[model samples]
Target: MALIKCSECGKEISDTVESCVHCGCPLGKVIFNTGNSWIGVFGKYIITDESGNVLAKLKENQQFEMNIVEDTTFYVQCNTSIRRNKVKVCVPAGEINKFLVKLGFLGIVTVVSKID
Candidate 1:
């Protein structure tokens, strides 16, 4: 099992748990996506939490999903030596929290939360 910080209390806890032991906050799933478009095929993207924890590395047309407590924010950044782009995503309490990452003009990155 891996340890993750509780979103409610910021305490380290097992990732396999259903709720935070410190704050009793319920766990939810956040789905991160890099669209299957041609623009995203150029480089890699890094996903992280608010604490600068690396959550996942995504390529073009790839996705990463994780369990996190309610009301948390995640950071998505382009993995590059130059012209790095970053975006922040706020996830709400739900089972279907989805976020999309895309590269815009001049390698600028953008994150959009999917509402469904």
Candidate 2:
């Protein structure tokens, strides 16, 4: 069996497992990727896997959700300020670092602009 680093826990694990034994992260055969688009003036975004599963969905000026396949789901609210050109994400939980790491660099992220 080939061992790979778990994206959620950074631990070595067999790539054949369906989930990370340590962190309970989904380790199915899928490559995680993100996509965003401006639909008629507003924006819509989604983080998808190679199997075309929507892990997270986001709107331009609305809240978003993450992890539909997992038992533990995280709901996050977000807003983009045009005046400062910044996007802010808020969650009720105080801890977020681990959760961010679990997502493995693909999620609903609001940026200043596509060009910049």
Candidate 3:
């Protein structure tokens, strides 16, 4: 088997494993999308894990995909100097999970799994 780096804990692991033994982060992929909008033009949005570890920084109209545990609930927050928005998401195994992040009225951040 090939060795790969665990996306969550950055430890070397066998690619055949179902989960990262080091941090329990599963090998499933999830997508996070930040659509292009005027509200996001000013600053970057920070995405972090439940333990407050930063995963990615997204700008307007950007998309990021990462590994996550299947059928588990995780939290992510959008942080800025004036406002913060936290979102909880759960993705089932063997299915595609896509989330959209947006800035709402009065600089409030919102994240939704469905477009409609």
TM-score of each: 0.65, 0.26, 0.62
Please report the candidate that would top TM-score against the real structure: 1
Question: Best-fitting candidate, measured by lDDT?
Answer: 1
Q: Please write out the lDDT profile of model 3 over residues 1-116, one tens digit for every residue.
A: 67877767889987667788898776765777878744444566667766777778888788877654345455655565255667777666434567787766666665555443
Residue 78, candidate 2: C-alpha displacement in angstroms:
43
lDDT of 1 by residue, 39-85 (tens): 43456788888999998988878889877656778888876525565
CA RMSD per model (angstroms): 4.5, 12.7, 6.3
Q: What clash pairs does model 2 have?
A: none
Give the alpha-carbon lDDT of every model.
0.73, 0.37, 0.66
Candidate closer to the true structure by TM-score (higher is better), 2 or 3: 3
lDDT winner between candidates 1 and 3: 1
Which should have the higher TM-score, number 1 or number 2? 1
- Provide the clashing-pair count of each candidate structure: 0, 0, 0
